[model samples]
Target: MRSGNPRDTDLWEWCCGFYPGSHPGECSGGTAATFDQARADFEAAWRLFLANRTEADFQAWRDHKAWTAEKYRRFDRGERMPHDWRPGQ
Candidate 1:
């Protein structure tokens, strides 16, 4: 559940976004495209992430609550900050 979709800001956010016995949300295409698009973003972002990749930096982002929230808000507003940035990650 990492397609970098707005509906899912992070692992916990994504878990909360779902309801029991319900289907996943959508990024587009009005289907499970929620996961599909996130996967696509992750794969593409992964490649770009290879250069100067830093587990620590990513960890820093993971632990940044305010920054993450800002990120999520950006996406929620249909704004693109950066692809590597996963909302509230």
Candidate 2:
């Protein structure tokens, strides 16, 4: 997200991680004066994140994300789910 208005932020911001599955401080993102800089920052953060985690952990996150996506697809198709079913649940 790029913003020029002073009320918001005079920089470009970007998030390179998923949510609802991400715990606090698990998301990778950053803001910079330019769009390219912001994207570079996000990429750097993502690389660091990968370096800090095991392959198994990354795979687990991928599986969870896929599951969440499938739920969303089912909902979109008008399939009925239990009342307790919710996105990311």
Candidate 3:
């Protein structure tokens, strides 16, 4: 996601991760001077998330990502999800 704070209009904030709802897990984000930079930074963060993982950890994340994707699809279809599930913890 890309966003800007009204109080800091000159900067852009970007984030990437597996988020099932408003809650985020295993997330990385940062601020940048321009929208393009923010987007690039987010992509870099995502790459780092993959690169830093052990093989086993990556497998777990893939599983979690699949579950998260399905949960997101269900949410798009208007199904409610329980709030207690926090990924990557």
User: What's the lDDT for all of these models?
Assistant: 0.47, 0.69, 0.68
lDDT of 2 by residue, 1-89 (tens): 66456865746777765544446587766668877888778889888766666666766677767676877788899986565654356
lDDT of 3 by residue, 1-89 (tens): 34455765646777676433223556777788888888888888889776655666656667678668768977999997667665543
Error of 3 at 36 (Å): 0.8
* Position 87, candidate 2: lDDT: 38
Per-residue error (Å), model 2, residue 79: 3.4
Report how far off residue 24 is in candidate 1 (Å).
29
Model 2 — which ten-residue stretch has the worst lDDT? 15-24
Please count the clashing residue pairs in each candidate, in the order shown.
2, 0, 0
Ranking by lDDT: 2, 3, 1
Per-candidate alpha-carbon RMSD to the true structure = 15.6, 4.7, 7.3
lDDT of 3: 0.68
Q: Clashes in candidate 2: how many?
A: 0
Tens digit of lDDT per residue, candidate 1, span 1-89? 34566873543212211122123341112223456555665555445444444565556545565566777888899997775754455
Q: How does model 2 score by TM-score?
A: 0.58
- Residue ranges of candidate 1 with Cα displaced over 4 Å: 1-33, 54-89
- The number of the candidate with the highest TM-score is 2
Q: Judge candidate 2 against the unseen true structure and give its global Cα lDDT, from 0 to 1.
A: 0.69
